[model samples]
Target: MARGSLVPETAAHAATTVARATGHRAQVDVTSDGAALAALGRTPLLLRVTAFSMFVFPSSMVIKDIGAAGTVPMILSCLLFVFWLASWIWRLHDPVRVRHPGRMAGVFFVLGIIVSYTALYGGWTGDATVTGLAAADRWLILAFASLGLILVAAESVKTMADAMQLLRWLLAGAFFCGVVGLIQFTLRVNPMEWVQLAMPGFTYNGGDTPFQARGNLVRVAGSTFHSIEFGVVSAMLLPLSIWRALYDQRGQRWFHWLQTALLVFAVAATVSRSGTLASVVAIAVLLPFLPRIARQRTIAALPFVIIALFVAVPGFVGTITDALGADTSDPSIATRVNNYPRVARMIDAKPWFGVGPGNYTVQNAQEILDNQYLNTIVSMGIVGLICVFIYLVLPGVAALHSARHAAFPALRCLAGASAAGLAVAAVCSVTFDSLSFPTFALSYPLLVGLSGAIWIMVKNEGSSPAPATTTPQTTRMD
Candidate 1:
């Protein structure tokens, strides 16, 4: 009987020992897992570089010298090259889906440009002047480089959280530039002179006017080369700012509302008719995506809001009317309008490959076409036009698809905003030669990539299995 009692006691002790061992192992695992998770929370160095690079890209080239303007993207390309090399060496697996039909179309577009470049310019001899086809050819190279860098950024984003981080950086940069533009407009100051003073080699075209004063009003170009570019950036941000103001209730909602107001004011100060129209279109596109209550309220308040705007701002309607009237009588407008037939003739002559990439300036006798569609057909022919269109349009289509199908309200809203921005870009391209300006050219493509990233995340989240639930227990010895 005593022996039986000893055996039972020993058995209980053994069980206790086993339970203690299991608990220790679990504690170690939890600690190690937590450390690993913390490590994972840190962003990659390459991604950080890319994000930083993109943030400064739009505003960095105050000095128009090749060495100065090209430095940012050149550095970015080197960093991205390093990342690419490391990925190959380490066999790293990227979680983001980099392959899309739109991106592929962009590749073909680049190829089309290359073919045109070869056929027209006889390849880069590095001795060409910075006028006509040579200048366009150089920009073509820059475009390809910019596109690659953007792709790297798009691929680096693994989740919506990652995308938001990148987006915040981008928005912050754009806003900073906008503020600079506001200063230029309000103070009648040009920051370019200061920039030139700071950078000895930087040269400003004496003829270029960043602050074109019209009576009491001024056209502000911000940190960019032109007012149109500034307007484009403002228009692009309008939809995003509106979305954040309306829906993003995470924290500091007032800040977003403030951003929206500032963006609207900035667009107005630009006095760009296309920019204003683009903002209107951007706001309109979000109507269907808004909740029923919000949509109805907004619609009801819109007329009153319009009345208040016209009442509050002196010469508000006149600003728009001036732009419209100027379009009819402005020599620049007349020149651009007259170029359409010339462009049509150019296309008819070289219908297949056109005049070559970036050859329009030379062909058009240095007159700006003011239309990207006409410019593309004149420069790159029908094939190039198709490729460019696909590259620009497909991402918008994907965003629209995600907007329609996404279960998450945030993602859906973002997708809608992206679609709206793209629509605005397309329409505005008619008034501006979009590809000529880095602010307009680089931004639209990056936004497209962002939409793609969001769509992928939404798709992945939808397909992921639900987490299994397990009940907690007071003791492990059950």
Candidate 2:
């Protein structure tokens, strides 16, 4: 009896010892994982670099020797793509484990561009200074770089903190552009001129003037290539600013609200119908998902905001109204309408792949299409246009899906905001060749990447076990 009792006690002691050892090991593992994530949280370095290149430098600024291809954002994007490829090849740890549909669509879109370009390799003819082959190569480079930005941006977000940091940087960029627009609109001065004076080896190629007039209102381009581009980008970013203002726990909320107001004013300063439409679309998309109080507040503020715009920029409201109500005979409206038959004819020739990408220059076509949808069809044909549609539409859909499934309210708000921004991009694409403008082109891809990042986070959170502690958890456990 004594021997049996001793045996049971020894067994119990060994079991307790093993349990304690396992718990200690787990604690160490969690700590190490937390450390790794914390490290990741600090490495939104690529995002910051990309944002700075996109927003801080004048969109018109290009390398003195390299022209359009030498723009800082373009160069950075290419480098980023190389880095992304190297990381993948080396099997670096990526927080986003799942293959997001948006990312896949982007890849397929790039492939489609290559295929289209390859199919028409030797038979292309165009009136542009750049040869068909050279133009196709440039377009392919841009496509790869854009895809690189999306991939890197999507992979950069390892935690909610990283996501917030990215949003904050984007908001800051928008705020900077807003302030520049305000200065240009009110003071009739281009801050980029001053920027140029302060720095040499950069040339501004936007246009003869940074400020233009629409009726009695001064139109501001800010740092973008055109006032329309500036306005559209501001409108697209407005939803994220609103989200930050409403839900962000970091810093003073009033500051974010101020940013939101600045973005709205910037959009109005452009006196662009497309910008106005984009802003309205974004707000409409966001309104349904907002909290009741927030929705009510937005509704209540509309009249006051309109009044303020009218008061501050005297002819702003009327200018937008007039532009929207402009007749089909209006030059811009007529140009877009006239391009349809031309584009349709061009599409009929190749239909499947059309002419190679970037071959549909103004010199060849006799006029710019101005509509990205039509432009894609003319340049890349039906397959490329389908890819473009999927690339543009899937991110927003995925983001909304993430919002619906997100466990955290903040994540849901972010997803909703991203979706709203993407909606603006899609709606604005029809009004202008958004991809032709540096600011909108870069900004759109960033939004796509961010939406993808949000989708990954939401999915990761939903599928993984509850974190042991709030200090950043890894998706996997050993």
Candidate 3:
């Protein structure tokens, strides 16, 4: 039978047939086992559970209690760490198959953070609600968990298909976030209020308030703790939705297109210039490599989409106008700008070791320094800055490496998306600490893992078995 004719039920039978035809019945059971494992690997449940947990678990409703310690993402991160450890012990997958090429860089980054934090031990002078040691411990826990995620992908994910599958699920979660954000924007409905009502005794951090605004328009916070969190989540989703709309032309193509629009509208409604800018950057980088027809159609429709958005949504245009406006009179913008000098001085004082992981907010209690780079420098010092470069910038580094090495053509798209996503995130970080929010924070390591996984597949493809006919790449796109 032809390869395409083989269904799941026949897959084992087909394997047996092939073995029998080759007079290798003695090896038939082995062949069947391999085929079964292959089929199991292609199952979507693992990706779905992992992605959904990562995306949705950060909500207050998902937490068992009010404190950061009780948050679902934190618990999930620990579980992910345990999973990685188990995988390591059981030799569940090739130990070195999906190595984080930036492992050395990661070590340096972590060391830098430790040294910085240790250097500032007992030196904290700020009035933080939490002690410096406690803050440092929280930061360390997150850092280690982020590292585990990278390692998990490295050890378990064996192909480009697996990496992209996780990405698809993440995009699905992002779509849900976008939909909720749209409702919040349209009706001014607070999902947090609903969560609070349903889950009694659930308290919100002062920072996790239900409403935020820019000028005269109320921003959409979605199910996340804050509007900026929702904006950043939407920003990250925007590119993936566009990539899906442009590429995946199989089933329900219009649905993908609608997903793309919802993500765009979600970003706009948040009235966040950084988030909107990040989406634009991702799309800009993504456009060049796309099939020509998709590129042109998407670009051509932009003007009409913008016009329709303004006409249909109340305060849409004005919200965007006020957001991007050069009005230093805008309190948020002014505060962010005015505080730069103080951050610069802080960084200068601790050029090597930073003022510890959680010192900045306490030290500069009244000021909100929106810049992530500055935040890193002051918080973790130059070493922390280097770590940021390794994780965030190295994906693009791997992408460029693959491009030069003539990796798989499909990998080019994944690399481009990864590079663009990270770039957009870096830009967003400059306006708001993108890595500080739970959703955005978790997203970074997840994407990093995906990037590393893709590079590993491309790097090892020459020796690996040819992709199955049921591979996602084969089914989802050309």
Best-performing candidate as measured by TM-score: 2
Give the backbone clash total of model 3.
Answer: 0
List the global CA lDDT of all models. Answer: 0.59, 0.71, 0.60
Q: Against the true structure, what is each candidate's TM-score?
A: 0.77, 0.84, 0.80
**Cα TM-score of candidate 2:** 0.84
lDDT of 1 by residue, 1-478 (tens): 1112212134334333222211211111111111211222122343444443443443344346553335443445434434443453444533233455445645666776776666566533223344656555565665565555455554555444445555555666666666767678668787655654554433443423477654356778776657777777777777766655554424476776666666666677677777777778777887776555556776897787667656644566687677667864676678887777877777777787666666665445347788787887777778778877766667667777878986554556667877787777777777787876755666676676567655655565555433232201101102
Q: Which model is ahead, 2 or 3, in terms of lDDT?
A: 2
Error of 3 at 12 (Å): 29
Number of clashing residue pairs, candidate 2: 0
Candidate order, TM-score descending: 2, 3, 1
- Candidate 2: lDDT of 199? 47
Q: Lowest summed-lDDT stretch of 10 residues in model 1?
A: 24-33
- Please name the candidate that would achieve the greatest lDDT relative to the true structure: 2
- The local lDDT score (0 to 100) that residue 173 gets in candidate 3 is 75
Q: Which of the predicted structures, 2 or 3, would earn the higher TM-score when compared with the native?
A: 2
Ranking by lDDT: 2, 3, 1
Model 1 TM-score relative to the real fold: 0.77
Error of 1 at 360 (Å): 2.3
Cα RMSD, each candidate: 14.5, 12.8, 8.7
In the range 248-367, model 2's lDDT, one tens digit per residue, is 556786788899999999888889998899889889887766655677778999999999999988877778888889988777788788878877788887787878887776763338
